[model samples]
Target chain A: MSASIYLDHAATAPLAPGVAEVMHDVLVGAPGNPLSQHAEGRAACAHIDAAAEKVAGLIGAEPREIVWTSGATESSNLALRGVAEFIGAGARIVSVVTEHPATRDTLSALAKQGVTVDWLEVDAHGAIDHDALAAAVAQGPDLVSIMQVNNETGVIHDVPAIAEQCAAAGVALHVDAAQSLGRLPIDVSATPIALMSLSAHKIGGPKGIGALYVRRRAPKIGVAAQIIGGGQQRGLRAGTLPTHQIAGFGAAAAQAARHGIASQPEWARLRERLWQGMAPLGGLLRNGRPETAAAPFLSVSVTGVHGAALITGLNEGEPALAVSTGAACSAAKGESSHVVRAMGRSPREAAATIRFSLGPGVDEVAIDAAAQRFRDEVRRLRTLAEAA
Target chain B: MNRGAADDAIRARFLRPTYAVDADAVDAWPASGAADTPGEDARCRVFLAVGNDGRLKAAFAAFGPPVVIACADWICERVTAQTVEITHTVTLADVEKALALTPTQRYAGLLAIDALSNAVINLGQ
Candidate 1:
């Protein structure tokens, strides 16, 4: 009861086992810049290369295709903006309305700069309609940007099918795999994704480090460099590489490749357990179809309770449950979830939604404790409402 | 007041709203007054009652952010067990001062005082 139960993994997961140690070793042992030609620099470059290979291995990409950036936000900005800049004015990009703000805001900025964008609407369950997507693709946009998974609802997009559609249409597809990297299998070789944005923290790697995979194969995708100076990462990104952070990211990716995929069924089981524990409350609305969502995520909106009060009660109660009402980025603004609203939920329902994203170290005990806390807070708030 | 500090004050009051009324206890009070500000996004209702001895008691139901709920809770606690005349004297300033409500939350104090005024008027009638 003293320790808080963490279920906000969609916001960021705890660092995987040995990731911190790997980072510590790199920080203490590697002191030279990777760009320098000295022996020390060569040593540093070797670490970066090794880390790159590990990360590339996870998604079936070559080490040369990985471009490191500052987490997924920067990766997304670089990918989308770079493409928009390369395509010049009048370039149209198709994406879903429910994408993370990193993608959405970047697209909005691109739109302001004269790039046309077609924002596809999602259905009530937060899944994009295939016919609408096909229609949009047939219109011949220069690029298609869609998240492999919705950060807020965990709704899995049919990326392989979408990739096929885009490929047939001669459109380059960019998938934001930030939330889906470890939770789902992604093979660039198997799927025709032209560009992919990845975040380390989402998969138990350190924060402040992410990667963008730019395909080097046939059809030859082109992306203009958004960050200038130092001419690093083939001038795609210029800042000096963070060796320790990259090392940690690599370790996390290695761990996920070795263990995370095999752990999905257990994650799924725990997610269902959590849902069942809270289901008896009777007025719960699952935000998206569970079958269509990633196994580690469950979002539910409560009826008969003040949204803010319910969040407060759960967060402040004994055995505090760490959960989010929406995307963690938007939660700080105290705004209702745009994702849920886009899914046709009323603002009130969106506000009352809680996203419980499980990751490493989450167990049945944690799930049951979180469920008990959720029930207690919902009942208390509902009773308080009834009395009033 | 700093927004974080104000939020902290509101959170403290919101987590333990001791004077919050329960539905089962409504029948025991003799005199009652209620007011509500209705909206799609933010809604609040305050219910006030006077004891047989003319002492005031209050409770509230709100569908708003923490600041509004905390304001109502603060007003109820401030006026509880006071004479009806004293309870009626509670003002927007008093609630605001107690809760350190932000400017956006100032409406909550006004809503609380309106409910209290209505209760006092009901008791007089």
Candidate 2:
């Protein structure tokens, strides 16, 4: 990492070391269509298959279960739309208000088309009410969609327990695991989840590749294909696969598998150190419960400070602390966070909230510096507010 | 079109806020007006203590994005020492041009106009 602190890993991580090398190799060495019958085409197909297996291994899934798409957005779109199309309209889907835009908006669109979308309410700490979810599932919805980890607050959802509920209710569970895939371990075989969405860029891979895991075993999910050009990936998604992107994603996933889980303790310590450094700023309120939130994340909202100014201050100062006001997409739109608002925060508190997501190479020194920068900026803005 | 501290003028004004309302001194202002622009989640309140000669001494308080606060600060600088009539003529376009605000930041300009217009109206009362 450079001297500037990059604490927005959930938005996107810097590419892992070997990722560039692998992508370059694929781009230069084997530039052939994977669908062709030639030797070069066979080699390209092997490259894609290897990438599929690596991604599958990361989630403890079968290689055949993975369907490649552009990114998490596409994966989520396919997972939600495909199921809705297959089950037909009038089928009910249960979800939460805190889902990423890809899932939330897709669910909304489905709702517009006569699919009943039951939005589950979250508590003040951003946790979904499990009893509510179970009750929704008991109503025999066709699918239950929720994220494995919240992108804004880093609140980790209890997906395994929810998956068990869905299984008992005979309802399909679709998890958007874009934020949790590499940072946390997910064993598909262990959990009774029916589908999942995974992203490459969020885990240090290339931006354009992602996967949707469709369970092919005993309760086979017969999803209709959203894209229909060339019948690639068993007619689920159709297009010429980009070998370079897939190879980069595979390289990133392999490295994350090696280090992501193992580095959690260090990340947790850094997160705590960051809180300690900023705790003296008396108005700081941690957004999520530390016990339940992911270790790489430290989300807080400062009272008596404008959120936009705080973000701008951090982003513009010396050694700019690259954090987020919320998800990158929502921030770009200049809209308040739906996730924060859903958790019952006032618009001001939601606007003032900052999400700091840590990753590899963000050490103790960086954490301390970032925390101090946050403290100084909040104090400066508070002074400005008071003076105003 | 939010200008950060990288813009030296915005940085200086935002950090110094030379004409910001000191909370303790707010009660002493003879006339005050406030406007809330709900669309942008911005609020701007302008307090004035007019001189005996009718020259205005303007102070402002605002809450919202940095751009809004910076715009309020810039407005305070521009409107101070001017006649009440001139303060009313401080258009939204003028604030936009003076601050180099972007298309998305036009709301801040509107907010500045509302607060200054309200303050000028209060001077009559």
Candidate 3:
């Protein structure tokens, strides 16, 4: 079939129809720059503000707390770097090695600049050790960044617990929450995070647009503003924001806030069917605790088979299927995900792992069919290997 | 084949696009279908049989009992204007065991809403 089964939701999700319609309407009706002093411009600005409010509402914050950025990378950088400069001085930043490259590299650079950094150890399941975080925060660091979810393994972290530790230390918590914002709940009141990243693409909004949740009255975690421009995003981010992207991102955030749980049942059902299908095959290992894992993702490793080959085999069928070996952004590098590595997997097993992510187009029928395809492909590939 | 015979002997099964399936039609065909026959050609489990640009785009596996495992495909007769989505590959043995039909019956064995010409057809080219 020409269509591949789409199981790559972690990389980016297909735009939901609701988000698409809103974007299309805004694109056609209001093409004005949101900052211009005209009726159309005012209308555009209103649309953007409403969208921002929608995004803020999802995380239980006021609209003004949301500062738009390019996407997860910029949002992440803004939160971490923003905190560093806002404090008007340097301090320690504790993060995990399992974090996305955005946070991982950000902290790495911070370390080079002599920022005290604590790269916490994770259990085999990729959970951040709370005691480690508590100890690190107890050191009186000014800023700490952690993700609400592990991108590759879909492991949910204890953001609230970590935030509590940071609060006790009078430290500001910056949650790279790009992965967990819509897939799971993230009420700022519950986590009380000083800074959190949000991405529209992850919630079916267009790419290149994200925002940071900056709490009012948050303790100063001064960060140097990287880009100097029109000072558009409340001096947090500068440059004329793309109205279309901002509008779309806001629209998607609103939708996620409203109906995020509606599409969840299908994912749970699909995962159950897939779990049953894959459980029978020997040498098959499911990576995370399903209950704690994200609804749409299931990372698994079949002994004696390369995850990439397995993906190819599954997609090579009718009702075309799609799957992935690891994070799409980093898959081309041919390295197993660092998140998987943090879970204590041997390099070979980690390399052989495949991630099956479902989204709007997926259902139990597709997943069950895919599970069979997965088994069939794994059997064929392993048999060939043994024969060779 | 007359309408009565076609109706009584064969019926088309409706499957989803690349839908999963397992039926009780494995008695009519030989043990190892095309791929495992150990004949001139070694069979493939699943891969693209036709380019996507073609009318019939799909992938499949030929297992024992002449079964077929395939992504969903449309089976249709232009004249009849009848179309059915073929989700799973039915094995020959499955046809025999499930329907208890013989080859002589022709279209009476494995017929769906789509085709009448090709009976016991596994994967489309």
- Could you give candidate 2's per-residue lDDT for residues A1-388 as a string of tens digits? 4539999898899998889999999999889999889999998988988998899999999999999999999999998899999999577899999999999999999988999999999999999999999888888888899999999999999999998888887888899999998888899988888889999998899999999999988455668899998899999999999999999998998988998788888888889999999998898878889989998988887788777778878886766899888742223244768888888776677778899999977888889889888888887777656634
DockQ of each: 0.46, 0.34, 0.02
Which runs in model 1 stand beyond 4 Å of their true positions? A1-3, A327-335, B1-6, B38-40
In terms of TM-score, which candidate is strongest?
Answer: 1
lDDT tens readout by residue for model 2, B1-125: 44652366665566567877877788889877778776666678888877988788988887767777788888888878887778857888888888777788788878877887887778788
- From the highest lDDT down, the ranking of the candidates is 2, 1, 3
- Which candidate model has the greater lDDT, 1 or 3? 1
| Full-model lDDT, candidate 3 | 0.64
Tens digit of lDDT per residue, candidate 1, span B22-115?
Answer: 7677666555555555542444555666677977677776655566678778877887788766774677888888777767678777776776
Ranking by TM-score: 1, 2, 3
Alpha-carbon error at A38 in model 1, in Å? 0.4
Report fnat in order of the candidates: 0.45, 0.36, 0.00
Q: For each model, chain A TM-score? A: 0.97, 0.97, 0.93
- Cα RMSD of predicted structure 3: 13.7
Q: What is the TM-score of each candidate against the true structure?
A: 0.95, 0.89, 0.72
Q: Model 3: per-residue lDDT, tens digit, A1-388?
A: 1365677777788887777778888888888888899999998898888888888888888888888888989988887766666654456778888888999898788778777788898887777778888888888777788888777778788777777778877888888878887888778866658888888888889998998777876653555667778877677788886877888888877778777767777787787788798777788767778877888878886666544444545554344457667542212233666777678776556666788777777776777787777777666656433311
Residue-level lDDT of model 1, residues A137-200, one tens digit each, is 9999999999998998899999999999899889999999999998899999889999999999
